[model samples]
Each structure stands twice: as structure tokens, then as C-alpha cells.
Target: MELFEHLSLGFGVAFTPINLLYCLVGCILGTLIGVLPGIGPVATIAMLLPATYALPPVSALIMLAGIYYGAQYGGSTTAILVNLPGESSSVVTCIDGYQMARKGRAGPALAAAGLGSFFAGCVGTLILAAFAPPLTELAFKFGPAEYFALMTLGLIGAVVLASGSLLKAIAMIVMGLLLGLVGTDVNSGVARFSFDIPELTDGIGFVVIAMGVFGYGEIISNLAQPEHEREVFTAGVSGLFPTKQDFKDMTPAVLRGTFLGSALGILPGGGALLAAFAAYALEKKMKMKPGEVRFGQGNIRGVAAPESANNAGSQTSFIPLLTLGIPPNAVMALMVGAMTIHNIQPGPQVMTSNPELFWGLIASMWIGNAMLVILNLPLIGIWIKLLTVPYRYLFPAIVLFCAIGVYSTNNNTWDVWMVGLFGIIGYSFVKLGCEPAPLLLGFILGPMMEENLRRALLLSRGDWSVFVTRPLSAGLLAAAVLMIIIVMLPAVKNKREEAFVEE
Candidate 1:
């Protein structure tokens, strides 16, 4: 009954004319971002953060949230039609989705993605609404020691679950921690790592790093590839809806994906990308029925499962951020920046202190999801035509857009140069088989972890045993240790590698 009343308040806020308009705009822009290869939600949101300065906080957040999940919807369009995944989470969709497209079933594949996503998104949102309040109540129990231990668990979880060499992931986290230390110390006003540059005193801007690493780095890497390699093979769209048989086959897969994605999305370092990958891998392991299409060849279940998982994961990934103030991934880290800009502190207090913002954001997602389904289907023709635009024409415009975004953040040329430098560094990470996503997470969490650690120590009178003496903190630390041990097991290591291997 209370949930219904809260939801009613949320709908009242979300249904306002201005909020609805912004939500629509965000969904459309997010779809556009998702259709374009390499222009991810993180970069787009970072670029637009400055633009939202004038809007109400609730409206700004509603729009930004729309972009994140809306991308999950739009990314599948390119993956199905052109064999190009516009979002990293859509990579698995490219495997069977593109195959389905080539086999002249693009329409069914696309419809499966759209409908599955809508259902999963709705489910994920409900789970979020149900779980967040209780989680927030639990978060109030965390002291500094517990908070530090939790962050330690988060960083280790990121390292252990991240796809690729474990050593490379550790290195990336260490590097990010070092980078985060450059700003002035909060305890002592002394600059720790700033090498006398005045701008370094304030620390490197988050926007610069995000735009450079994700935006410019992706552009530079794409430009390095041969033009012919970048061209897409778009299949024609004919049958716009799935067959009844297709529906039967995909429904179970979609249900499994939604459940799996909702669970994993709450974990640190697990988001849409991991959910999609895991969903497809799970489906592949299921025994095939005698007459069913194979896993990779025009399998409607293949198209449905990963799409549902990614969308579900994207929606539920908001749980930790809203409840605990811990960002689960790089994109959520950008959202942290967005919240700070609006002077809204994310965490348990948000619900009690700002109920409208909390519930409104939740309700807006349902509205936005409905808007995406209505917007994506009829606009398929337009989205497909967009793929026809050449990369040669696209790269320069993207580079310019990134430069302008970086420059506008502080209106400083140094930040622009800093972004360019990070771009080179980001490209180098790609060449070295490093995942930059964990780096962003580490960078965002490093300072918070340091502050918590210091506070814990201060409260404990410098007793090192404080971390282990507190029951909650001790338990969290134990979990982190157990996860590390499990990940190091030979069997688990092999299975992890096999699951992440690209099809």
C-alpha cells in the first residue's frame, strides 16, 4: 500500500509536462547515441552534463537515466541490421543478431530485441523499486570502517570478475588510484602528486578523462582501422513482428535473462556488458530442442536473451548508486558527477530528504521505457539509414564534439590538452589489452575509500585491528578474500575465460 502511494507521487512528478518532454528528448537522443558506433552513453552524458545546469535536478536526472537505458534499446538495432554493435553490451547481440539478419530474418530479430527489452526493463524497474528502500535502510548502519571494507570488496570484485588477464585489471586499478591522488588532500591542504601545475591542484576534471578515454580514444582507434573494415552490411527490414513459434522459444530465455541480469546488475563491476555476455553463454549451454534453430544461426532466443539481459542490467545497475552511493560501473561514475553538479548527494538520505527526486526518477524510467518502445519501432527505417553515413564523415565531427565538450567543462585549454593526453593513454590501454572501465571505477572510488580509511583509523585511535574488529566490516573483508580465492581456483579461472571469449 505504501509502495503504491509512493509510486503515485512519482507518477505525479513524472507526468508533469516539462519532465515528460525532457524524458522524450533523452530517449530519442539516447537511441541516436546507441545507433552510432563508438559514441557511447558515457561520453554523450558527460558532454551534456553542462547543458543540464539550468534544469531542475529531477528533470536532469530523469533525462540522463533515460539515455543510459535507451541506449540498451537502440544498440541492438545496429547489431541486428549491420553486424556493428553500437554499445559494448550489444556485442553478444551481434553474434546471433547479425547472423539472423544475414539469413533474412532481421525484422523478427529486431522485434524480439525491442519487445524483450521492454518486458525486462519493466521487471528490472519493479525490482529496483522494491529493493532500494530496504537497501537504503540497511546502508544507514554502515560506519566508516564498514564503508571502507565495502569499497575494498567492490574494487576486488571488479578485478576478479573483469574479463581479461587478472594482472592487467589489477594494473589498471592501481594506475587509477595513483591518478586520483593528484588533487589536494582533504585532511591536509598540501598537494600530494601535483607537479606544480596550478590546474593539477584542483585535480584532473572527470569530464576530461571521460571524454578523452571513451570519446576521443574510441575515435582515434576507429580511425586507425582501414576504412573498408569500418563499413557496415545492413540487411533489409521486412517482417516487423516475430512469429508465434519465435515468441514461444524466446519467452523463457527472456525470463531467465531478466532474473539473471537483475541479480548481477546489483553487484559491483557487473553491468549490462557482463549480463549480456553471461546470458548468451547461459543460453548456449542449454540443450537444444530437435527442431529449434541453432544458437548462432538466426536463433530468435539468441536475439532476445542478451537484449533483455542488457536492458534489465542497465536499469537495475542504478540500485547501488541510489541506495549506497557506490557506482557500479563507469557510466554510473559519470552519473555521480551529474548528481554532484546538482548538489544532490546520492545515498540513503536521498529517499528521506528528497522523496520526489527518488521516486520520480524511478517512475520516469517506466515512462521512458514506454517512450523507447514507441519511438524505436517506427523509426527503424531512419536508424538504418543512419548506418549508411560513412565513418570518414563521422570521425571529424565526433572529434570536434569531444573537443568542444572538454573545453566547455572549465573553459580551459589545459583541460582540452589533458583530454588529448588521456586519449593517447586510453588508446594505449586498448593496444595493451587493458579494460579502461575498471580504471574509471577505481578512480571514482579511490578518494572515497581513502577518506573512509582515514576516518576509521582516526576513530580507532590508529589501531590497525579496527578493520577486523568490527563484525560487519570483518564479514565484508572475508567475502572479498573468499572471492579472490574462488577466482584463483583453476577450474573457475578456465570457466571465466571461456565465458568472456568472443564468439
Candidate 2:
């Protein structure tokens, strides 16, 4: 079969010695960072983006993929141990996961998380393998009009699905789109919002925004918290995994989460955070075994559902990036940057032109998932020790490294200073309860939207009807409008916000 042949090629590439080593390194590093509260994969990957320039394309992607999913694996540990989420997706896990730890069921809770994640990751990957080809085919049919319409849908999805105030999310996205317009116009060769700064002529660097907003923003937020590091749990955490009955209770939750997460992960703005929260909420709404643990108090279903959903979501989030060259989340946006660094375009042609890199990256995810399971369980002790380190010492070193990384991106101190200014903006977003992920999605998509819209108009000789005349493009635009309307309904808006709440 075509799929089998592709897998053979993928494994051959992913199994190379160098690729395997990087995979191991990435998994280990991701686990380490993911165990530390307040640091997520976006910042970590952004920190390491420069380092990947030295790596072969396959190896670079293999390692970054490991970090992305490995964080999912390591995140549950902190959620269970310290009542903190290392990744945003793990936030829902903390509700019941920490309760399990408190009730002396940490071992079982962790086992459920690990096992559920591994299973769901495999299913998500399988779904990706089966569906990506068709999606890629569909993508090839798109024109400039269709692309603009699809991007409209994506931006709307980001606005509707983001977890804070809808107004704030919209504002953030509009800001990102506006900021995306700060560079020189392609057709006119005139600067729009460059403010006469040389660096602004090329637009703001995605790396700087990512590092400043995700990295430095997180540092400031963490520093603002009081110096109160919780002691790591040692007892009830070292032994006693799930029993037969526990497995019986967990199997259904894992299945539900995998299906739910796989479907949601393909949608714009529906990444691990949304999937996890949705799955956890759905589990609570469904009927449970009469004698089982209650919803927020050491429920294995709680651990399994969110953990599985997050991993599934993390894997399936790649569909948009790989198929359409559109990034569905901040992490996928980072992956787009990675692909561009290697001079590989992140679209349908990638599969036809570079099958090895594409398939190998897919295969590497399964390998990374396996590696995460092996690395996370045995290295739990080391990860726990990392959490014990004080923020006072940890944050300064982080800020210093981030500064160095941003400056190293273009070898310009101006970029570093710009990152500092963005850091303030990032912190302001946090204090105002605004989510930055949608802003990131908007920033990444804005330029692409403008280019396509311009192209569509040019092709149509300035005819505005071109967007509505094409059936496919019109359908997509209609869906975008429908989505916005659905989300704006009072009941749906309430439920949407409520579903994304951690607890």
C-alpha cells in the first residue's frame, strides 16, 4: 500500500543514528523543561530554534517533535505531583491528578496518564496518516480566493475557541494582524508602519515575539508569584500502579478522549489545551460508574481523559501545518518557522517534493512517544529534583539565556531590545487575562491572508464578487461566518468559556 511504502521510508530515515540521538536528547530536555512549572514547549522550542540551524532537516524536526510531545508526557507528572500544569493542556489534569496525589493514589494516576497518553498518541498518529493524504489532495485544489477564505475561517476559530474574554481574544488577534502589516508592501515597495526603523522594514521577527511573549512573559509571571515551592511527593508515588478494575474504568475514558481529541485537533484553534478541557468536561457530563471516584477527587477517568486528549491534540495539530501550510497553534507556528529555516515550504508540495522529511517527521512522532514513556517513568526522580529549584535562581538564568537566544537569531542587539519591549506587552497581556496563542495564530496567518486576498483580487481584476463566485471559496467563507455567529450566541459563548475553564 502507499501508506506502507511511506512508513518504510520514514522509519529508515528516523532510525538513523544521528536522528535517534537527537530524539533522545529532545525527549530528555523536553521532560526536564515540562516538569518545571511555568515553562512550556513554545518558549523552549523558541529558545532552541537557533540551535537547529546546525542540524540536518530530518534531525532538527525529529528533535523538535520530541520536545512538543515529550512536554505532554512530562506535564502530567507535575500536574499529579505539585498541583501545577507544566503545559497549558495539563491544566485540566491538575484538577483530579493532584487530588489523586493527595489521596495517596499518585502512582495509579500517573500510570493512567502515561498509558492513556501513549495509546491516544498512537491513535492520533494513525488518524493523521490515514487522513493527511486526502487533506493534502484537497489543499491542492485551493486558489488564492479559497486560501483567503480558509484563513478567515482559521482566524475566526482562533477567536471563538480561545479561553479568555472573547473581546480580549479578538483584540489580541486584531493586534497581531495589524502588527503583521508593519513591513514593506510587496507590490508598492513602500513601508506602511515601519516607523523608519531598518529592522521594521522586514516586519517583526516571529522568534523575537515568541521568545519575548512566551519566554520572558512567563518569567515575569513566575517571578510575581510568592516564593512558595511545594515539596515533591515521595510517598504513594513510587509504586502501586493501576489495578484490573482501574484499567476497566480507564479504557472507556481513553477511547472517548482519543476520538474527541483527534477530531478537535484538526480544527483551527483546537489544540491540546482545548481538547483536554473539552474531554474532561465531557467526562463529567456523561454517566459514571456508581461506585467510582468522583469527578475532581482522584478520579482515574479524569487523569486519563485530559492526558489522552492533550497528546492526541498535540499530534493532530500537525494536520493543518503539514497539509495546508497553516499553523493551528503557537507550537505549529514554531514548526512553520523550523520548516522555513530549512528552506522547505510547509504545504502540500512538501509531501510530493520532500517525502522523506515529511514522512520521517511523522514516523519520528511515534518513536518520540515511545521514547517519552521510557524516559519519563525512569527519570521521574531527576525531573522532581528540577521542580525543587527556586524561581529566584531559575528565572534569571532563563531571562539571560532568552536574551542571548533572541540576539543570536539575527546577531543584532536591536532585536534583543525589541524583545524586551515585547516582553512588556506580553506581561500586559497576561495581567489583563488575554490569551497570547490566538495572537500568535493571527500574526502567522495575517501576511498570508493579505497576499492571497491581493492575488485573488488581481486575478479577478478588482472584482469583489470573485470571493463569492467560486463555490469552494464561498463555502469556506460561509462556514467562517456561521462559526462566528454560533460562537457569538449568548448560550454558546457562556458554554464555550465554561468548557475551557480548568476546573
Candidate 3:
């Protein structure tokens, strides 16, 4: 009954004219970026971050949340139609989604992605609403030791779950940590590696690194590929709904994905991407039979599972950010900044003191999901047409947008130049077969990990065993160690190599 009352209040807040409008705008903008290959929600949100300053806190957050999931919806469109995934979470979809397109099943594949996403999103939101308060309460008990251990577990999980060589993943993580440390030391008043640059004192803007590597970096990598190898949208989409078999096959996949994503999303680091990849892995392991189609060969479950998983994962990532004042990913870190900008401390107190923002954000997700379904379903034809735009014309526009976005962050040209440099570095990572996503996770977590580690040490009076003495922290560390060992085993190593080769 209390839950009902809270939900009713949330509805009242979300139904306001301004909030609804913001939600609509976010969905529209998110879809636009999602349809374009190489552009991601992270970059788009970073570009739009400055614009949100004028908005009411609830309205701004509602809109930003809409953009996040809306991009997820839009990414599937390109993945299905053109074999291009604008977001990392959508990469798994490209496998079967493209194959389905080749077999003239693009319409069904797309419909499955949309419907599965909507269903799972609703379920995930409900789970979030139900679980968040208790989690917030639990978060109150965490000390510096717990946080440090949690981050360590998260980093390990990110590397293990990322799709690539373990060595390369570790290297990328170390590089990210190094990059994160380039600014002034927070504890001491001394500069670490700023090279005497004024901008370095404030640290590298997340926008610069994200856009350079994810946005411009992707553009350069795509341009380097032979034109003949680039997949084009040639399939004529005829239907707007999935068939009976597609519906049947996708139902279980969606449910499984929702459960998996919701659980994994609460974990720190690469939650959405890991959930998507893990869902695909689970579906492949299940070996569900579709009519005359193999797992990676135009299977509807492939599209449904990952799509559902990513959306669910994206929604549940809010758990840590809202409850504990801890950001599990770069996007969540940005959300923390948003909250701080509004003078709201993101912790257990938020739920009690700012019920409007908490429940309101939850309610807005349902509204935004509904908006995305209505907006995206009818616009499938429009998104498909976006594939017709030539890469030559598209790449320059993307680069220009990235530059403008980076510059707008701090009104500094230095950040823009840094973006360009990172773009080259991003391109290099691609050429070397390194996964940049883990680097992002590492960079986001490094500072938090350092702060927590130092605080834990201080509390324990320099005791090195504090991490191992705490039961919960020790358990998480053990699990992380076990995960590392399992991944390094010869059989598992070979299997991982084979999976990447297939991708």
C-alpha cells in the first residue's frame, strides 16, 4: 500500500507537462544518435550535459535517462539493418541481427528487439523500484574498506567479462588507470602528472576522452576499413511485427535476459555491456532451436536476449549511483556530477530527503519507455533510410559534432584538441584488437578505488589485512581471484579466443 502511494506520487511528478516534454525530446535525440553508426549515448549525453544546467533537476534527469535507453532502442535499428552497432551494448545484436537482415527477416528481428526491450525495460524498472530502497539502506552500512573491495571486484569482473584477450584487457585497464591519474592528487595539494597545464589540474574532461575514443575513434576505424567490407542496408523491411514463432522464442529469452541483466546491473563496472554479452552467451549455451536458423544465423533469440539484457542492465545501473553515491560506469559518474551540480548528495539520505527525485525518476522511466516504443516503431522506415547516407558525408558531420561537444563542455579548445589525440589513440586500440570499454570502466573507477583504499588504510592504521579481514570484502576478493583463475585456464582461454574469432 505504501508502495502504491509512492508510485502514485511518482506518476504525478512524471505526468507534469514539462517533464513529459523533456522525456519526448530526449527520446527523439537519443534515437537520432543511435541510428548513426559510431556515435554513442555517452558522447551524445556528454554533449548535452551543459544544456541540462537550465533544467529543473527532475526534468533534466528524466530527459537524460530517456536518452540513455532510447539510444539502446535506436542502436538495434542500425545493428539489424546495416550490421553496425552504435553502442557497445548493441554489438552482440549485430551478429544475428545482420544475418537476419541478409535472410530478409530484418523486420521480424527489429520488431523482436523493440518489443523485447519494452517488456524487459518495464520489468527491470519494476525491479529497480522494488529493490532500490532496501539497497539504499544496505549502502548505509558500507565503509571505505567495503567500497575499495567492491571496486576491486568490479574491475576484475569488467576485465574478465570483456570480449578480448585477458592480457590486452589488463593492459587497457592499467592504461586507463594511468590516464585517470594524470590530474592533481586529490588527497595531497600537489600535482601528479599535469605537465604544468592549467586544464590538467582540473583533470581531463570525461567528455573529451569519451568523444575522442568512442566517437571520433570509431569514425577513424570505420574509415580505415575497405569500402567493400562495409555492410549496407539493402533489405526491404516489410513487416512491423514479429511472427508467432518469433514471439514464442523471444519470450523466454527476454525473461532470462531480464533476470540476468537486473542481477548483473547492480554490480559495478560494465554492467550494461556485460549483461548484453552475457545474455547472448547464455542463449547460445541454451541452444534453443529456431526454424531452420542457427544461434548466430538470423536467430530471433539472439536479438531479443541481448536487447532485453542491455536495457535492463542500463536501468538497474542506477542502483549503485542512487543508493550509494558510487558510480559503476562513466555514464553513472556523469549522473553523479549532475546530482552534485543540483546540490544533491547522492547517498542513502537521498531516498529519504529527495523522494521526489527518486520515485520521480523511476516513474519517468516507464513513461520514457512507452514514448520510445511509440516513437521508434513507426519510425523504423526512417531509421532504415539513414543507412543510405554515405559514410563520407556522415563521418565529417560526426567529427564536427564531437569537436563542438567537447569544446562546449568547459568552453576550452584544449579539451577539443585532447579529444583529437584520444581519437588517434582509440584508433590505435582498434588496430591492436584492444577493447576500449574496459579502459573506460577502469578510468571511471580508478579515482574512487584510490580514495577508498587510502581511507580504508587510514581507518585500519596502515593494516594491510583490512581488505581480507572484513568478511564481505574478503568474499568478493576471493570470487574475483577465482574468476581470474578460471579465465586464465587453458581450455577457457581457447574458448574465449574462439568466441572472439567468431565475432
Candidate 4:
């Protein structure tokens, strides 16, 4: 009954004219950018952070949330129509989706993706609403020590789940933590790693680092690729609706994907990318019925399951951030920056302190999902036309916009120089085969981890055993240790490597 009342308040807030308009804008922009290969929500949202400064927090968040999940819907379109994946989470879709397109089944492939994503997105949002309150209740029981332990678990989860060399991932995290140490110290009121620079008194801007590394850095990398690599499908799309047999085949796969994606998305470091891969793998392992398509050759189930899983995962990944104030992935890390920009400390208190913002954000997700379905299906023509824009024209525009966005944040040239520096550093990370996502997670969590660690030590009068003495803290630390151990096992390590390989 109480949940219903809260939902009523949420709907009332979301239904306002301004909020509805922003939601629509977000959905449209999300699909637009998502249709173009190589650009993603991370870069898009990072570039838009400064623009959100003037928006009401609820409206801003509603828009950003729409972009995040709406990308899941848009990404599948490109994955099916062309060989390129518009979003990282849609990489798996390229395998079967492109195949379906080649066989002149592009329309049904897209319909499956659209319908599956809608169902999964709605389910994921429902789970978020039902579970967030309980998680908040559990969060209030945590002390400083427990918070520290939880962050430790989060960082470790990032390291374990990150693709590529484990050693490289750890090094990237360490680099991020070191970078986070720059600027004035909060405790002693002294500059630590500022190098005596005047601007160092204030910590580096989150928008600067995010835009530099993800926005500009990605553009640089994309430009480095040869122009001959891109291949767009030129076949005209027809037969917009799926057949009755198509519905029967993909329905169960969608259900399984929704279940798997919702569960995995709540875990630290687990998000849409992992969920889509895991869902496709799960579907591959299932025995096929006679007369059904094979695993990779124009399989509608392949399109449906991964599309469903990714959207669901994108929606549910908000659980940890909204409840415990811990970002589970790099995109959520940017969301932390967004929350901080509005002076809202994300945690359990947010529910009690700002019910309108909390519930409104939740309700806007359902509205966004509905909007994505309507936008993605009929507007397919526009998205396909966007794919024709050449990279030579697009890259320069992206670079210019990124520079402008970075400069607008602080109205300072030093920050612009810093963004360029990080862009180079980000490019270096990629060249060295390091995943930048873990670096982002580490940077976002480092300051909070330091604050909690110091507070715990201060409370315990410098006793080192206080973390283990608290049962919840001890359990969390133990879980982190166990995850490390499991990830290090020979069998698991091999499997992890195989899982990340796209083909």
C-alpha cells in the first residue's frame, strides 16, 4: 500500500510538462547518437554533463536515465542493419543480427529487438522500484567500516570482471587512485599532490576527466581506424512486423534474458555488456527445436535474448548507486558525478530527504521505455540515414564539441589543457591494451573510500582491528577476498578470458 502511494507521487512528478518534454528529448537524442556507430552513451552523457547544470535535478536525471536505456534499443538497430555495433553492449547482437539482415529478415530482427527490449526494460524498472527501498533500509545499518569494505568489494569486482590482462587492469586502477589523490587534502587542510599549482586547491573537475578520457579520447581512437573498415547494409527494410512463428520462438528467450539480466545487473561491475554476452551464451547452450534457426545463422532468438538482456541490465544497474551510493560500472560512475553536481549525496538518505527526486527518477524510467519503443520502430528510417554520414565529417565535429563542452564547464583554459592531457593519457591506456573502465571506477570511488577509512580509524581511536570486529564489515571484506580468489583460479581465469572474446 505504501509502495502504491509512493508510486502515485512519482507519476505525478514525472507527468509534469517540463519533465515529460525532457524525457522525450532524452529518448530522441539517445536513439540518434546510438544509431551512429562508435559513439556511445558514456561519451554522450559525459559531453552533456555541463548542459545539465541549469536543469532541475529530477528532470536532468530523468533525461540521462532515458539516454542510458534508450541506447540499448538504438544499439540493436545498427547491430542488425550494419556489421558495426553502436554500443559495446550490442557487440553480441552483430553476430546473429547482421546475419538476419543479410537474409532479408532485417525487419523481423529489429522488431524482435524492439519488443524484447521493451519487455525487459519494464521488468527491470519494476525490480528496481520493488528492491530499492529494502536496499536502502539495509544501507542505513552500515557504519563507516562497512562502507569502506563495500567499496573494496566494488573495486575488486571491477578488476575481476574487466576484460584483458588482470595485471593491466590493476595498474590502471592504481593510476586512477593516484590521480584521485591530487589537490588539497580535506583532513589536514594541506595540498598533497597539487605540485604547488593554484588551480590544484580545488580537486580536478569530474566533468573534465570524464569528457577528456571518454569523449575526446574515443574520438581520437575512432579517427585512428582506417576508413575502409566500415560497411553499412544497403538493403531496404520491409515487412516491419514479425510473423506468428517468430513470436513463439523469441518469447521464451526474452523471458530468460530478462531474468538473467536483472539478477546480474545488481552486482558491482556487472552491467548491460556482460548481461548481453551471458544471455547470448545461455541461448546458444539451449537445445534448439526442429525447424528453428541455428545459433548464428539468422537466429531471431539470438537477437531477442541479447537485446532483452542488455536493456534489463542497463535499467537495474542503478540499484547499488541509488541505494548504497556505490557506482557499479563506469556509466554509473558518471551518474555519481551527476548527482554530486546537483549537491545530492547519493545514499539511503536520498529516499527520506528527497522523495520526489528519488521516486520521480524511478517513474521516469517506465515512461522512457515506452518512449524508446515508439521512437525506435517508426524512426528506423532516420537512424539508417544517419549511418551514411562519413567519419571524416563526424570526427572533427565531435572533437570540437568535446573541446567546447570541456571549456564551458569551468570557463578556464587550464581545464581545457587538462582534458587534452587526459585524452592523450586515455589514448595511451588503449594503445597499451588497458581497459579504461576500471580506471574510471577507481577514480570515482577513491575519495569516498579514503573518507570512510579515515572516519572509521578516527572512531576506533586508531585501532586497526575495528573493520574485522564489525560483523557486516568483516563479511564484506571476506566476500571481496573470496572474489579475488575465485577470479585467480586457473579454470575460472581461462573461462573469463574466453567469455570476453566477442566471437
State the local distance difference test value for candidate 1.
0.86
Error of 1 at 270 (Å): 2.6
lDDT of 1 by residue, 41-123 (tens): 77677667766777899999999988876776777887888777777788889889989888778778888999899999999
Q: Show model 2 residue runs off by greater than 4 Å.
A: 229-236
Candidate 4: tens digits of C-alpha lDDT, residues 1-503: 88989999999999999999999988887777777776678877887777788999999999888877666677788889877777778889999999998888988999899999999999999999999999999999999999999999998888887777899989878877877888788799898888788887787888788878877777777778777777776656788788999999999999999999998888787577789989999999999999988877989999999999988888899999999999998889989998998999999999999999999999999999898888888877677778878888977887788788888888888998988888888787767888788888888899889999999999999998999999999999999999999998999999989888877
List where candidate 4 sits over 4 angstroms from the true fold. Answer: none
Query: What lDDT score belongs to each candidate, Candidate 1 first?
Result: 0.86, 0.87, 0.83, 0.87
Q: In candidate 2, what are the lDDT values of residues 1-503, reduced to their tens digit?
A: 99999989999999999999999999887777777777788888888788788799989999999888777777788888888787788889999999988887877888899889999999999888888889999999999999999999999988888887889989989998998899999889999899999989998998999988988887787777676555566543566478999999999999999989998888888577888988998899989787988998889999999899988988899999999999998899999999998998999999999999989998988998898888776666666667777777888888888888888778899989988888888888889999898888888899999999999999999998999999999999999999988988999988887787666
The TM-score obtained by model 3 is 0.93
Q: Candidate 1's error at 431, in angstroms?
A: 1.6
Better of 3 and 4 by lDDT: 4
Across residues 383-436, which tens digit of lDDT does each residue of candidate 3 receive?
Answer: 888778888998888788778766776789898899999999999998998888
Pairs of residues clashing in candidate 1: none
RMSD of each: 1.3, 1.4, 2.3, 1.4
Cα error, residue 80 of model 3, in Å, equals 0.7
Residue 431 of model 3 has an lDDT of: 91
Q: Predict model 4's lDDT versus the native.
A: 0.87
The pairs that clash in candidate 4 are none
TM-score for each of the candidates: 0.98, 0.97, 0.93, 0.97
Q: What's the C-alpha lDDT at position 148 in model 3?
A: 83
